[model samples]
Target chain A: MQNEKMMLEIQQKVELIERAAQAGTGIVEIGSFVHPKAVPQMADTDEVARRIKRYPGVEYRVLVVNKKGLERAGAAGIMKAKLTVSASNSHSLSNLKRTPEEVIKGFGECADYAVAHGIELSGAISTAFGCPFEGMVPLEQVMKVVSCFREMGVKELSLSDTTGMANPRQVYDYCLGVREQFPDVTWNLHFHNTRGMGLANVLAGMMAGIKRYDASFAGLGGCPYAPGATGNIATEDLVHMCHEMGIETGCDLDQSIAIGRDVQKLIGDDRGSFILKAGKCSDVVCS
Target chain B: MQNEKMMLEIQQKVELIERAAQAGTGIVEIGSFVHPKAVPQMADTDEVARRIKRYPGVEYRVLVVNKKGLERAGAAGIMKAKLTVSASNSHSLSNLKRTPEEVIKGFGECADYAVAHGIELSGAISTAFGCPFEGMVPLEQVMKVVSCFREMGVKELSLSDTTGMANPRQVYDYCLGVREQFPDVTWNLHFHNTRGMGLANVLAGMMAGIKRYDASFAGLGGCPYAPGATGNIATEDLVHMCHEMGIETGCDLDQSIAIGRDVQKLIGDDRGSFILKAGKCSDVVCS
Candidate 1:
């Protein structure tokens, strides 16, 4: 029964990837290459990666926790990977069983492997906004990890509001600071809607000239450390906001809403999205 | 029994007004001075206004739908009133039994009353952003109403997203246009959370240099015409966001939260606010 469930999950993930590609998603984070014993949800990530058909011009990325995880990703044929370390020391200790400094050293080795194997690596600083155990994350702590990525020649860098404790002003100020410090790096924002400021933070980031953002279908992902928190910002909601703002995200809003419905059915819940409940602004005609 | 319930409601509204004043709210819309037969929800406006103790320096404004409503407000000793009419012709006819043109002509008499009685009068353009009956509301239509108010010497003006169909870009552009046209007016923004863009629209308005906003306590108010729509943005949530952004809304956050809790208890539901569920971002400590 367990084997059957794993296979089914893998197949479902592959279908999700295909749907995501069809919806014009340029990049998709398939799964984390963490220890299966620790994160059982991602146990079939390797099989999913091996079995999934890749769309042309679309990049598939997996999360690498350490050098061992990077090696596993390499073995599983993941040409692109997201290398992340928690900016909060408490989060690092709890989630990775290592100090933030220790994770940075391990990331050095992982970055070296990426360079050696010609793998595209994007460095992400988790808990960049706040931490459940650490309260407000100072910019210096986040920049420490950012500087490491900068030193590693990581051109693509992401800042994750891991617990979604970000406000618009904070996002605007942080994005401005990052742009000033690392003008050459491509900045990506990863937000969760745990506190319901996800889309607002995205708007702030856009005002600060950030065009790339990370969202999940049906807002399906959540932090294991933060209980009662909602998942990532719904991709359909993000796309809806963008389309309404006249910003062409190249994603079909109708198609995205359909996928959100499918994901809601697959998960057997519809509590994740606002656009799914309130349709598009243009959907209701005043007859 | 109906009279007893009306008295109870009047008492509750009076208490709510006092609490809002204590929460550092400078302006509170007390009630609408409409005909009791038309809007029974506001039937006891005269009694509520008479019984409620006025907070020093806090302006208690009532809405006046017509010249008769203005006279009733004057009789009730309401020193401040919001004179408003629907921007959409269909909404105007349905809600007020008048065309948009007739409402504007009647507002001329209401404005004259304010000037004669030395009462502070602000004008609100209802459905300035979008109308459910008219779909996308043209800016020209809104400006026509604005022009009428401008001609009537109404300097304190507000634009209301009555159906909550506004996007950030649209808000920014419209506000810029309004500011350019009515450079000297004190502009206020009223947003609804019906589509979950309320806070985002507030941010946009703030970026456009708008300092005044309208939020209902516990998000208690909704458009009578738009069924299934959420209420106005919660006061505590608005205060929480402003405080987080370093903007002084003069509201006590903890006090506001307590009031929100009281309101939740009073209303017997907790579906109105995000802050009521998540608490403030600074509520958690890193220890």
Candidate 2:
């Protein structure tokens, strides 16, 4: 009953994706192709991928843990897949049942499968900044993961602060160091608002010249391993900040806020979305 | 009955202030010396000031709106006070029943009273970043307030984002501009987390060479005029970020978090305090 109630149907997932695309989101991580028993909420990912009315100029991607997940994503007609490995061994073992090194070693098969299936592969290093069980993930571990991704022919990569352990200084220094070390690769940042430093870290990344970021609608999604942690930074909050700072994000602020509100209603709880609660700055009237 | 319940008696206020001092807070704004009818919550500020066990080296200050408020603070034996004026005319009119210019112009009497009473006075420009009633406050208006504060012999000033409407770029530029324009004045930053940009704005301010900031314990305190706005950035969250980034704030993280949790319980609600919800990064153990 819990699973049934918590899960979204394939049609609902597809509709949400379409809505996001219509709201001018350039890229959408549709769902994860994990074991149905492991993540029953995403059990209908394949069906959702097949049903989505794909919008032109919008890139649709799915999370694929291994070669099998990639095959499933390919079978569902998804063109882009992101393979992830935790930078810390404890988190990797706890979440994926493999060490970081072991996970990267196994990604060779996934890379070959993606190439054969004509899938565009991107990489994500979970807990790149820090891990829930392992306090601070060292820069060396993140560099090793980046090296492995580069060796696997992944040109686009993201460093994810899985439990929001990243601070602005660490983000700025790390982004600058990584960019200098790997100039050819495109780096993206993913941050959680667990410690209220998500937007601050994003500002740091921007200062270091990192252009891409990963944020969640309605600030949905949290790490199961990180107890009492909040979700990712809200997409509307990021977009709102970007627009306010004279940085154009190409996303409609009102529509994004609407989507966040709808998602909040569906979840039946308050997500960490500030814009949804306070309305946009522009919405405030001049007295 | 409502006022009695909401108002913290002199003894309780003293206890809270002493607790904050024992927790290693270097500066504490004990209470505002506003009229009892106007702000019943702070009606006992004078009594609290007289009763508290003052900590040596820890500066105790109270909020004073005018010369009468300053006189009351002086009579209560408080040695430091903060005088606030909104940078936006709309916010100034709504909160103080005077325009920004009028409020600043009236501060001459406050300055005279502080000098006669031998009290140190600091100035704060509310809505310096953006006004809730008037979307964006111009830098010229903020500069004008700064000039007035300087004229009134207030060498220390803070730029407060009263409604959390500030973006990082705006914050950085404004901080840089104000510091350049008035190098002799000691500038501080204050932010609200209403739109989730409080810490981000703080980060920008720090990047632009700001060393002092004002944050609320348990993130308590909101603007009555700014609809749906949350409170100031949590003090614990700021200290946590500073510690993680290797910046010395001289504030104990664990103690601050404990105070935040206590305040949360006292208020009978969940405050916008990140560190209170999630333990410090050091508290996370490696598995």
Candidate 3:
């Protein structure tokens, strides 16, 4: 019964993804190839990847943690895969069952698999801003992970605030530091709104010249370790803010908001998207 | 029964203000002197001002809308008062029952009363960002209000986001404009967390060199006109963010969070103050 319910939920998610793609979402992370027993929600990753309607020029990406995940992605025929390693050793050990050094060492086989399978691979450094077990992450340690990914021939990288412990000043300074040290890498930011600074961090990243960010519809994705925390900055909220500031995001704000509202209904939650409740600032009809 | 309960709440709020002053808060707006029927939450404003314990060197400010409120504040023995007028004519009429032009025209008597009584006065431009009845406010209109305040001999000024509709880019640009145009004015910011952009706007204001901000304990206040809106940024959240950024706010974060927790218990809600729920980031101890 539980498996059937999970499969139904997955189907609903894929539908939401297709709608999001039609509404100008260029890239979507369909699911993660973790052990089904460990992350039950992602148990049907292969089915999701296979069934999700891929739009023209849109990338359907899956998260891969090890060689097994990479093989699963190949089986699922996923063209793009994100290989993520936690920056903190304690987090890496607890989350991935390996230390950071061990994860880096083990990435060789997975990188080779992606190269051979014609999969476009991108790297992510989780807990780059902070860790639940480690209060503040050192810049040198974060840079070390970046160097390891660069050594693996990855050009696009993401810095993940797994704990939502990032403040605007830290984000601005760190983004500048990373850009200065790794000028050739395309850097993306992933922030959680656990401490309610997600959008502020986005502003800081924009000030530091970062253009790419990771957001969830209705802010659905959150850190499993951070209890009572909210999810990533809502996609509609981010797009709405950018558009209100006269920054062109190339995404239809109203369409994204409608999809966010629809996703909220499918998930039975609207805790993440403020626009869902408050409407747009511009909606306050001008006389 | 309702009036008695409101009086009790007012007593509790006065105690909170006293505690806040002891915790290094140099200024506190104890209550607003709007019409009792219009804003029943502040019906006992004169009583609150008369009863709230005042700390030396700490300004116990009351918000006054016109000559009648100014007289009531005087009778309450308030030494410092904030005379606020809305930037949007619609908001001014809706909130103060007078047009913006009428409010300005009426300020002359209030200004004279303050000067005669030796009351240190400040002017606030409410709805300076966006209006519920009027979408985006023009910078020229905001500047015109600032000029009118300056003409009335007020040096301290507050730019308020009456509906919590201000964005970061608008804040930064407006702060710079205010600083350049009114170099001698002691500029203060008043923001609401309605769309979760309050702290982000505070960051932008700080980047543009604003030193003082208005925050509500436990985020206790919101515009009655802005439906589905949250309160001002929580004092604890703002102070915690500042401390985390290495900025000295001269306020105690733990004490403020404790007060916020207490306020939540009193109000039977915890919708504001992430720190009240998530605790401090430094609470995570590294092994």
Best by lDDT: 2
Which 10 residues in a row give candidate 3 chain B its minimum summed lDDT?
A: B1-10
In the range B206-275, model 2's lDDT, one tens digit per residue, is: 9899999998878887777666566899999999999999999988888888878877777777778888
What TM-score does model 1 achieve against the real structure? 0.94
TM-score order of candidates, top first: 2, 3, 1
TM-score of each: 0.94, 0.97, 0.95
Interface RMSD of each: 1.9, 1.6, 2.1
Between candidates 1 and 2, the one scoring higher on lDDT is 2
Instruction: Tell me the spans in candidate 2 whose CA falls farther than 4 Å from its real position.
Output: A1-5, B1-5
**What value does the lDDT take at residue A43 in candidate 2?**
81
User: Which structure among the candidates has the greatest DockQ?
Assistant: 2
Give the proportion of true interface contacts each model preserves, from 0 to 1: 0.47, 0.88, 0.66
Docking class of 3: medium
Top candidate, metric TM-score: 2
What fraction of the true Cα-Cα contacts (under 8 Å, chains A to B) does candidate 3 also have? 0.66
RMSD of each: 3.1, 2.1, 2.6
- Give the local distance difference test score of model 3: 0.83
